[model samples]
Target chain A: MEIQRLSIKSLTITILIVIAGFSVLLSFVSGEYFFKAARESQLYSLNRVIQVATKEIMQQLHDQAYDIATALSIEGEIPKEFVKAVKGETKGELVKALDDPLITGFVGAYIIDLVKVRAYDLKLNFIAESHQGIQGLSPQMPKILYQQGYGRKGVARSKAISGLWQHADKSYYSVLVPIGGIFISGYLEVVVNPVNNLVRLSEKMNSPISIRSGIDPKRFYYEPKKSTEKLLPIEYELKTDLGASAFLLTSYEDIAKLSEGVKETVFNTISVFIGLVLIVLLIAIWLFQLLLFKPVNLMLNEIRNITDGDISRDLQVKGLAEIAILSGEFNKMTKEIRSREEVLTRLSVIDALTKIANRRKFDEVLKNEYLLGCRSGKPLSILMIDIDYFKQFNDTYGHLAGDDCIKKVATALKRSVYRPTDLVARYGGEEFAIILPDTTKSGERVIAEKIMSEIARLNIPHSSSSVDDKITVSIGGYAVVPSIHDDPVFIVAEADKSLYQAKGAGRNQFVLRNEFNSVI
Target chain B: MKKNYLISFIVFLLLVVSGIARAEKPFAPEKLQGTIRVDAEAAAELIVNTPSLLVVDARKEVEYSKGHIQGSVSLLDTEMTLEKLSKHAPDKSTPILFYCNGERCLRSSRAAAKALEWDYKLIYWFRGGWNEWVDKGMPISR
Candidate 1:
């Protein structure tokens, strides 16, 4: 048994959905990789921002320290003791002057935020200094004077050396400025606190922050914790200039938001893609109905009609080429079946020996003609013919020769009737009949005489015949305008009686009569 | 017109009465653990004497810019974070002095205690703050 196939529409939808599902899966995997790339880029940019901010804060510190140092150098220009102290002409003169309340007043009045100021001589000797730089730090020649950046080349070009120096347990920048104008007699060191600038650096970070400096709990800094699940903490160690542990900078960035956004974007895109695929699926099924299924269904209906016995139905092929071809082939098959049926019908009503209408055909034609005569009130005629002595002819010439003579008599008798309305049949062995519609009494007699002459014309030898040594027939015919009261059997019976009368008179003769009182 | 004026006068009287009724002190509490309370004169001395002293104005930016200690750094108390406090005073032993709008503002008191809580040892809160400093005609930056 053949398994029922899935419908074309169902098959189309299934194929389309499978393709869409595969595409969605492929894109989802690719999207995951794309999200990974995006996360990596974000982390890269975040690291860059950290480096840039650190550099900015350090630069700002140098700039502030540089500004203070330049001011101190200019203010100290008025004091002749600075010049004297720089040339080694006076060892403590600049110190003494800077220590005076009046000189302190003048300088403090000039620079408001000045915390510490140190003046050095040409030979890098501690010449004079103010007291307010870093707490517990005494005035001394900066050891950085001998450092690489501040050595002979620096002194020659008058370049400044700068950095955050840890003095008195405090970190601050000390900037050096030349005391004299272009001649460079000495250098001034101005201290700038880095605490304020460093504290404000938290503003550069986008997330909540914490910074732990060394092992000291006091130096450990952080924002209050709000959520542990959403905020993922991360830390990177910042090494100091001396290569020791500087601080552990920690932060909790809300990375879930980014991942969630990526997921939502992927979901929305997949949904739209599926939606589009579904629309295409619907369109495909409809197109199959229009361009394929409908035409095939039409052909199926025509075949169904043919199965129900409407063999004359011709199909109108339509739609796609394959279905049209199928319909065309079906029409050809039906035409062949109809022609075969016609041939079978013809064979059933024909005689084997005579090749003419058999007894059954003669009876059917007689009944039809009688009914037509009843309606039209016209004369209907029939002639029954018998061989004079066919049994003797068969004994003399053998059955095959007798059958040949009967076939010849059947053909000649058929030729005697001209109209298509007439029917000639072999009623039985060695017997024949003819039906003529719309014939008068005289018309019946004329047809009977014509059939006798036509049969005699064959001239087949019959040595056993009582009348002559040639094949011959005696005919009996009757004509009448029949009515509803008369049966076609009565007409056939009357014609048989007439055949008996002719046979009784003698062989090779006919008696023709009409039941109607009206003559020809 | 006379009746309207009378009603206006009555409303004004009610406002005055309410103002007097709600004249509560704006000063922060006098005592606090983990901190040393000092005056403006002591604060000034700490600035000049201590080499490692960090003066902080624990007030809003607007208040600090109006008039604050000359060497003080503005670290707003309301906006203070441990990272910010530690960045200013990384060493626990560093002497950090805090001040705000005199006795009327509690920002300095809170900020000074917050510093000590972060393990800083020397947390000084100047109770007199800017008011006493101005009254004494001490040096001003602006």
Candidate 2:
């Protein structure tokens, strides 16, 4: 079965595909890792920046609220009114004093979006508030302040405490301060809008900022105005002095746009990398074709021609080391094969024992010559010679000596036919046949006589022969101007009959048969 | 022809016998004794549960500092000495577990063999060591 083969072109293509595929995969993996690391690092820095910005905003708001509370308590009648309202003495007058321009203007100065001011009694009951619709008392207000060591025995004794507080869906930064002079009478609370603070911080940092208030955990505020596809958000929890939770989510300035540049650079680099890889692959393929494939293909063609019985030309050996060596070896192999074929051709037709054309070669030559004679209307002749009493000779002196006698007779017969066109062959045991092209009956007779005389001249000793004291041969000759209808075998049979006649008359004689006459 | 066949048959028989002689016995856990052989899980348990069990990282110090089994002390295979062993683990009878990179590493085995030669009463060889430990998500220390 013939196996499927991969040609050099396809094999190189496959290898190139695998290498290119691996390069693309490697680049994709490394590119993803690089982008991921860049995003993470940007997010980390964004988180730190957001934390610092949030702290600064909270500090500024806390100081402003403290100033407002301290001014109302030290220079105004609001604290005394708060004490009267707490003792239940002239509550309407206390309410009227709380609404005076001095206190109202001071509270109005600090009031803005989502910011509110409230005054609470020592019992933690709410007294007056800048914003309307607030409840009379907020019991949940000062809990974080007390936990952060800001409230002592239900009085604000420490510095102003700032924290995050929630109402419905909105969050506020609340600062609590004591409002009394000598003894603590009430607690003052200032709530400021964290969304405005975060927006200001975002502008100051030149980045996008969003706030996720711990009070209102489900809502986001101060979101930037941009597409967030490439933005890496960094989140940091804001912890005030009172340990309140306010989350700040921010990202680098134009983070989405910045990452686009990174992606573009990476894509460009990968394209160039792939281009370089393809260029290298093409160069490598050209080099291989020049240095290996071209030479190998030429050698292959030469080997095929050698198999087809044409081994005349040697391959041109030129390439790299291995291919050059291969070409050289292939040329050497073809030379060896040609020499061996010549030796085999010679061995096939020559008689191993007699050193003359064997029977098979005689038949081939007779047929070919007969066909040629028919075309040219030329006379072709055959002389069938045999050693007389050869069986008796073999019986008297063993087969080995009989073979030596036959070799001598065959050599004599070969010498008798001197024409270049004539052929002498060992027909069978003790019998020889000669093909004589363009020869007449008279010419055949002369050759027949010469062969008989030549073998008799050898004078090989034959002890048990009645023919002669020396070995001799009988010759029978047949000649014809062969027609297309005539078979060469008929002439061969006629020669054999004449050979029998010559032996019947006497050994060491010649006989001839032509178309019109027969002679002895 | 018959002699040729007889010679060929004798050659084939010799080939078969030689092939059988070259065959090895299958691994049996019972063949490994005199040293307690533990896997990564058992070694991690010994390090965590036994405070006195000296968990030794049998690799170079550079590799040890990169990452190793938690609470393991670096003791390289090439640096194994009686003095160094006594300095870290003075009590000869104290249980000691040695581990290296992984199953393909021979450092831990060599260190364990050396500890045995030192006449230590308890020596544990963690065959599947740091590689298996990290793969299994066990604790690691640098």
Clashes of each: 4, 0
DockQ of each: 0.01, 0.01
Q: Tell me the TM-score for chain B of model 2.
A: 0.76
Candidate 2's displacement at residue A357, Å, is 2.6
CA lDDT of every candidate: 0.72, 0.74
Misplaced by over 4 Å in model 2 are: A1-32, A48-204, A208-253, A269-352, A441-446, A518-520, B1-142
By summed lDDT, the worst window of 10 consecutive residues in model 2 chain A runs over: A150-159
The deviation in Å at residue A354 for candidate 1 is: 3.7
Interface C-alpha RMSD, model 2: 25.1
Q: Compared with the true structure, what per-residue lDDT tens digits does model 1 show for residues A1-520? A: 3336776656666777788778778877877887888777767766666667666766776655665455445444423678876555864656565444334543332322345667776656667776434455656644454363344532242445555444443344566766643235677666655545554456766666666654452675554345545675555555444444555566556778887887788778777877787787778778887988778778778889889999999998588888878888888898899899888878778998888999998888888888888899988888898988999988988888988888899899888999999999999998888898998768888888888788778888888888987888999888878888989999888888888888998979988767842322
Docking category for candidate 2?
incorrect
In candidate 1, which residue pairs get closer than 3 Å at backbone N, Cα or C atoms, i.e. clash?
A115-A132, A134-B51, A135-B51, A135-B52
